[model samples]
Target: MQDVPRIIKAASLRHLTLGLAALLVLAITLALPAGPAAADPGDVEAASRGVVRVVIIGEEGDQPVPISHGTGFAVSPTRIVTNAHVVSEATQDDTLRIGIVPPEGKGGAFARVIAISPRNDLALLEIAKGALRLPPLALAGGNGANLGEVAAVGYPMNVDLAQGLDMADIFSAQPPVKSRGFLSGERPSRQFDTILHTAPIARGNSGGPLLDPCGRVIGVNSFSADSSGGDGEFYFAVSLRELLPFLRSNGVEPTTNTLPCRSIDELNAEERQRLEAEQSQARERMAQRSEEMREVRDKARLTAQMQVLAARENRMALALIALIAAIGAGYAASVWRGDAARTTQARLAAAASAAALVIAGLLWITRPGLAEIEDRVAAALAEAEGGPAPEPTSPSTAAEGDLICTLVPDRSRVTAARTDDVALEWSADGCVNGRTQYGLGKGGEWIRVFAAQEDSAVAVNTYDPATRTLRTDRYLLGAEALAEAREARAAYTPPSCGVSDAARTLGEQQSALIAKLPDRPNERLVYSCTAKAAAR
Candidate 1:
């Protein structure tokens, strides 16, 4: 029996302990906040388009042979960045030529060394005129934090050696290899500052970009730490401290992204949540409005009934008074039969009594019917406001001319898109800036599609006059698809801004071009617009 009590106590204690643990777990779960959203994988691929292979070619007899090769990235459509050592031979020897191989394409273009700094090991090369244009990569304004995620994008020599590419294959265009790791720390050299990261790099990765999760350039890959120390290998990149000033002094202004990095999935989730909350609030407002309307209707019905009942009672009372007057007047006429002057007064009273009786009959017949309750209720509500009721209005559908549109960041998902105010001149017939005619899309918004020969992007722009909003979606294409888009653009001759018929035809052509585009764009920018005066 003693053992039984002890066991029971032990069981009770165990249960109490489990209950406390459950409560503690619940509290802790509630206390802990959500972690940051994950970075989009597409960011790396999109940024890799800017990475190129810098090949140093030398003349061997009548044929051009590659002497050395290194990696570089586009700072502008025409300018490229690489290590000074990669192109030093070309700068010294006129026979050695510099060839720029893009991530995608059949062949490479030639470039000339415009700037070189041996101390910083950074060199700038300008692509030849009429060469293909590469999209520029944005540079981060802030110094990246230690242990943050970083990615090295470049064309390493090991890949070429592993694939056993010949001289002809080496000079051809191919995508760069990507290595992802965490940033170690900032290791500033005696001459210049550098970023230490764990992302692996090889010989040919000399001047490639060290990118943040958002694909912004944080540094330029320079060299790697010696692995002979038994410690894990770490690579060093020329940090933005040296890279930014070098580019700025050379009159290069690449796009800079300062906003916090967020993935499309996270943006979409937040947008869904916002829409749900807005819908919930709308439902609540509708319920509240219904309650208010019901109250008004009840008050109006009660007021109308009371007024009708009061009128009916007044008519009955007046009828009784008229009947009494008629009886009194008849008695007066009989009593005044002997006197001529009094008889005339009695006859006049009798005539007035007949008129009163006729009015009473008309009043009794014309009392409001039961069917008039709703009509009277409506009239009473309208009359209470001192005028007739007004109809409901909707959003404006008129043309908005000479307007300035500002970016709405919260409602937008931007990667490499610019965050500047857009200027627009709109017409009622979907003409923009008095030169370009836009087609009316299925969604009732004005749309324009553009695909240029030199650029590797297809742009679709849409504007909603009702919401006074503008949106631009850019689809970055590879070499093959871009060629097709260029062909389509060449075939379609856009009409000038004029009649609706021309606008309709333009829309058909735009739709045809759109059909040839990819299903989705890599970046989308949304802007809310207002009149120019309001913007000022």
Candidate 2:
């Protein structure tokens, strides 16, 4: 009985010991791995759009029941990628049906199994033409970097059970769950290439996309280990090495992105640096112009003063010479008073001297003043440039005519969009492509805002003519937000081109709506534009 107290103490400390070990493990996992930045909410939201639920339906006594459920993601507009086991029963039995529940909307869609690789445990299903359309997730060019951050997006069955959702609810569209963790390593499975990650996933999460911080598809979540052996749960995803060939063999072209993953904070910081550099350059330019103007003014003043002084000295000398000539002529006339021809010549000389004296007085009275120095400087500077100095104008006002705009990747953050150059036709009257009218925004930018009905995306496009920069920001909204945006769009009427006041009013209205949007956009594209030369 003496060891009873010691046994009790050990039992009590068991829970504490386990708890401390768990904490230590968590701290190590979080602190040790040098991974990409954490996932952004906007990026996750955008990536989740393509994630769907793959439900297997079986009919029992004329009643349809969901026999199995798993997750899948769009690889193309009409093709979905999922695990072979998810639809294996349906493939074996023709009567079994496969249903796809999108991330949004009212009802589910039916799809046909196009390709199934049992060895790789992968399958491709094609949705009916024009039945369902979802933005395909962009696959990462490589499997993934070790210890990098990753997110798994999918519809887990445990969640449905926890929410107590019925079969009908399962068919209805709903958003998927996102679990974030770090990539452990590349551990190829016995059957196929696989990437090992720590992103939590359940049975129903199979075939979902494992994404990077930038919302790029790094791998396809397929399965998880049965036991972690004291570590946290680890999951495995099908690597792109296997997925690429599988997709190509099926003739499905997947969108792949090779750009490095960057967080919004980094992008914002870079933008701030760029703006500061521009401001510094602008200040330098202003200082240089001020110096040039000072030099020009000083030079003009000196030249004008020298010219005036020379003119004055010449006038005084001419006046003195004329007086002396007049005195000589008077003396000649007196001496030659009796000679008529000499007297007439002397009289003519005196008249000419008197006229010269009047001209000198007028010249001295009409000499230029100090104010004329500024005028001379302006004229000199204008002459040097071959025209009057141009007044500074807003960039938006100067961006007109046909322009070829190339992507400024350093100044932009692109998640799922293309980097192709854009051709724009702009008019000085705020017309785009000669049809769509753009409103003048508060920042002196020409802006156009629109929300697509086909997708839950709102886009704001802005153009700064001064910088010749065009920017497009896309917001992937949820159901409620999309509804609100649609309502806002319905209430507003776009103004016609050339109506500055109306366009400004519309811009203000749109700006108010924009203010209500999330701080960061899902995708941002910036293009530097140049005018297209006229065809000869």
Candidate 3:
């Protein structure tokens, strides 16, 4: 009762204790890891791959000169996005040329402005046909760029930033610089929706990409706040809301990935986890299937054994009955001898006994055994488990006695023989042609492999599902064709060899090589082998 006042005083301080607790929580949250320090390095590298240095090459009297420069990135195979101001000279005058220097490569190609929006300060440039194709950067999803950890990827301040480098170094093969900062805010109703951030940029940094923590292009670096060399001043970018529409209007569709980006180390860890999960699932399924097969095989084997046992018992019973009859007949023959008729009856009874003994001996010799039944059950079980042969990898893979090769048939591989008239498929079992033995096995994308050859030549063919194109690369052997391929040669379908003049010309190109091979029977390409066809 005396302490009632003390207790009331303590109650009055309860609000103050709660306020302190709330302050403590705020402090903890602020102490958490922030910005670029927490972002993924792998994602930053991926985004930088699409960034390029834009050099506006202009004429100074007679000699060509690299005029003003800025940064840009690929949005499509042939289209680039940059600030309209960066390429203003080119857009205004046709003679002022635009050249794109990729982050990783030396040679660059000239470009022409395909679309421009002076109001939005955005411009689209198209590289000439057959130039180096850079990996296109995809815009963020419908949610667009928001306040989070961001990366600014581009080449900033030319000779000033990088010490002891001339203009040539600026335009050479070098990856863009990366800066990490927090995307803090946005301008609600500005021309060309703008995003505000603290990522550092300079004169040549304009038109670079502003990527989210997940490596998505959320915005493009447009301009910075009037810093007057202030350290804490903000920078701004053109958000995806305006960028997406601008690209679509100009007939370009950039790639997009909504998946969250992780550091390379983290990504590898996740991949290992996924593979382990799938392997475990596959093992479980195989075990279950094996158990089911065992049960079915056991039941069938048991039924067969029982039938055999029953058959043996039936033969024994018949043999026993015959023996008893034969014994009785033989005894009757021994005891009976009264007249000439009686003697004849006795002889017949003896003959009947001999015949019965012969029949019993044959039955014993032909009895069913357990070993034979076991062999049959094993064979049936093996058949249930995917037969005895290994599955092939590609349509054209083979291994012969002394050689092994994996061949892919392009229509160009065929000359005088047209595709419609000839079949170029491989057999399921495998085949052999000349010194080369053809075999198909599961694994690898190699088109040509010569295991015994001294020349370490190999051909690799990669296919893109999006464009439905196949690109082939031959290592030492195709060096002569490299120039032609670099110029233009991804898809290779030969002209029809339907007794045409063009076919005759093309055959000459392949004839010299084809003539060198040693001829062998069944040397033709085999896609499938039918039992009926084989029999013929």
- Clashes within 3 Å, all models in order: 0, 3, 13
List TM-scores for all candidates, in order: 0.83, 0.85, 0.58
Question: Residue 471 in model 2: shift from native, Å?
Answer: 0.2
- Give the Å shift of residue 12 in candidate 3: 59
Global CA lDDT computed for model 1 = 0.77
lDDT of each: 0.77, 0.78, 0.58
User: Local error of candidate 2 at 458, Å?
Assistant: 1.0
Per-residue lDDT for 219-309 in model 2, tens only?
A: 8888776443464566778888889999999999888877667766787899999999999999999999889878877887788777756
lDDT tens string, model 1, 436-501?
A: 888877766689988866555788999888778888888877767778888888888888877549
RMSD of 3: 17.3
* Candidate 3 residue lDDT tens string, 1-536: 34423422321101112244334433543565553435555556655766888877767688666666778998876788998877876777777788898876467888888998867778899999998676566676643434468888887764334576655465676778889887765664345687767787776777899887656788888776554432245677888878888998888877664433444444346648867998999999999998989896997699768877877777777777777777887787786655566998888888887777777766666667667577667767777776866765534333112222222231122111112222122222222222212222123221222211322122333322222223333232222232333222222233332323432343343333323322311011212222233324
Q: List the residue pairs that clash in candidate 1.
A: none
TM-score ranking of the models: 2, 1, 3
Query: After TM-score superposition, what is the CA distance of residue 428 in candidate 2 from its true location, in Å?
Result: 0.9
